[model samples]
Target: MVFPTGSLVNLIAIVLGSCAGMLLGNRLPERVRYIVFCGLGLATLVIGMQMALKTQNPLILVFSILLGGITGELLQIERGLNSLGERLKKRLKSNNLRFVDGFVSATLLFVIGSMAILGPFDEALRGDRTLLYTKSILDCFASVPLAASFGSGVLFSAVPVFLYQGALTLFAGVLQPMLTPAMMNEIIATGGLMILGIALGLLDVKRIPLSNLLPSLVYAGVLSYFFM
Candidate 1:
């Protein structure tokens, strides 16, 4: 059995990057960090567009997003995620004012990207770790400035990263027999839209409630199973 090596490696990279950032303190300039984030955002945008283009069923994709967006809003998934981040911040008893911000931002940044979803699926379905490996390197760099600016709270994001991706990997393994190539393509396309939103947020263009769109992935799969 192939382990979820990708997530484990990603978790370690985040931790190490956070520690390095904290150690470096204010040495890393704000402008440099900002540029790095911008570069990441652009890269994410390109990746998302590519993934979105893979869908063979555009109508199903639209319906999945619509239905999933409604369900997610009704459930207040984004609010719940923010509330969880705030709770963790309080529980940690850290005086850092940016603790919650760091935790929430890092969590969204790491989890909302296309790689986060597709990488796990690949690993579980085909034992391929290429995307996850690439994501790990990108995330390691991303974590450094996040920790530098937001303090140690950035490290906690690793927890959610492991939990979210690890669960996806396991779930994908279970569904491997049922999921067709078309289903996978639709699911990835839905995730790509959410990733585009995240990219906008990272680029400081606009903030979208991406967590609220999580259900879109499920909708994509269901819609594909039935219609495609």
Candidate 2:
């Protein structure tokens, strides 16, 4: 069996960081946690802007977003994700801005973007897990502050992170061939826009139903195929 060391390390980092954050949270004042959220929001905006700017053609992205949004709405993807988050929150008996809050936010933050996709693809193809390793470190630090405010549910994010990237990594040979360079960039752009939405939501400027746009990632590729 090909050991997925990169993914395993990423999981370990999230768990450790979350646990450490939880411990630190117990001692830190609530104000400190709020500050962390604000900082993360600013950082996310910067990152999102960078990714959004990477697209060579703006029209393709606009169409992709519009179509993807419609598909997501028709499918009720956001509602399903919200329902799942709420149910898990109830089962865990978590209170305030924790549990479901952390899970959804952290999962989206960790799951989308180019690194989450391309990193695994490269790892499987070239045995170079550098991008994933770098991402793991960033996630470790990010998770700490998130767990401080969002609660232990942040730890559960590792589940989606591992599974999503692992699947991509394991099947890189098949998927990579299907995604042309242009398609990949468009997909990354869409993910960046979603990440930007997540940032805006975090900043309390708007409440974006980001999960509703999950189909946007795939739509980006499709749209790119035609535009390319």
Candidate 3:
């Protein structure tokens, strides 16, 4: 298969899944939606904890987040993402919390995992799209409840999912030297931190501008290259 073709399939899966979820959601009671969202949140926290545990050095993760967060805030990355999400929201005439949460949470879920990293690289190096295709299938199913609980904003998340994984697939050769296993672990660990915040937001515990932390993934990789 062509490189990133799997990502295309993945995108299709998420879109179809979201459509199905939206249909199903309209029939569910508000209380049931709330319960499902909470369960997803708790599950997210558990997943984040598991990824975070991959880090060999917590200090590296900490530094990557602090520094990368500062950079992201300065660049207003969250504002940029919000603007994009808002464009879609305005088109739908929705200013709902679930919409925003769905977009943010779906993007995080689809983009943060090891599958995202390995899928693209494997495709580039081995002409193998198995991992990405698998991820797409997984995302397809995962997007259902997320869209059901949140809203159409979950559909918009497919944009980032495509860009992130697609770029990695196309550029894997150039990035190979930089993306060491150690660095990959740190990146996942940093993402786990972001995922934790997403979980809290979903649970109604507290709101987190998790988008602003996106740069930490890059920063963690850089730090890992030099320090690890």
**Whole-model Cα lDDT per candidate?**
0.84, 0.86, 0.85
- Candidate 3 lDDT at 179 equals 76
lDDT of 1 by residue, 49-71 (tens): 88788889899889988998899
Best by TM-score: 2
Candidate 3 per-residue lDDT, tens place, 1-228, comes to 245887888899899999988998889898987888788789889988988888999999999889988988999977787787777898889866678668877887889887888888889889888998889888888788788888899988998899889998888889887677899899889988888887898789998777778889998998888888
Number of clashing pairs per prediction, in order: 0, 0, 0
For model 3, what is the error of residue 173's alpha carbon versus the real structure, in angstroms, after optimal superposition?
Answer: 0.8
Number of the top candidate by lDDT? 2
Tens-digit lDDT string for candidate 2 (1-228): 245678888899999999999899889988988888899999999898898887888888888788888998999987886677787778878775667778888989998877888888878988999999999999999899888888878988898899988888888888878999999899999889999998998888997878778898998999889878
TM-score of each: 0.86, 0.94, 0.92
lDDT of 1: 0.84
Which residue pairs in candidate 1 collide?
A: none
Better of 1 and 2 by lDDT: 2
Off by over 4 Å in 2: none
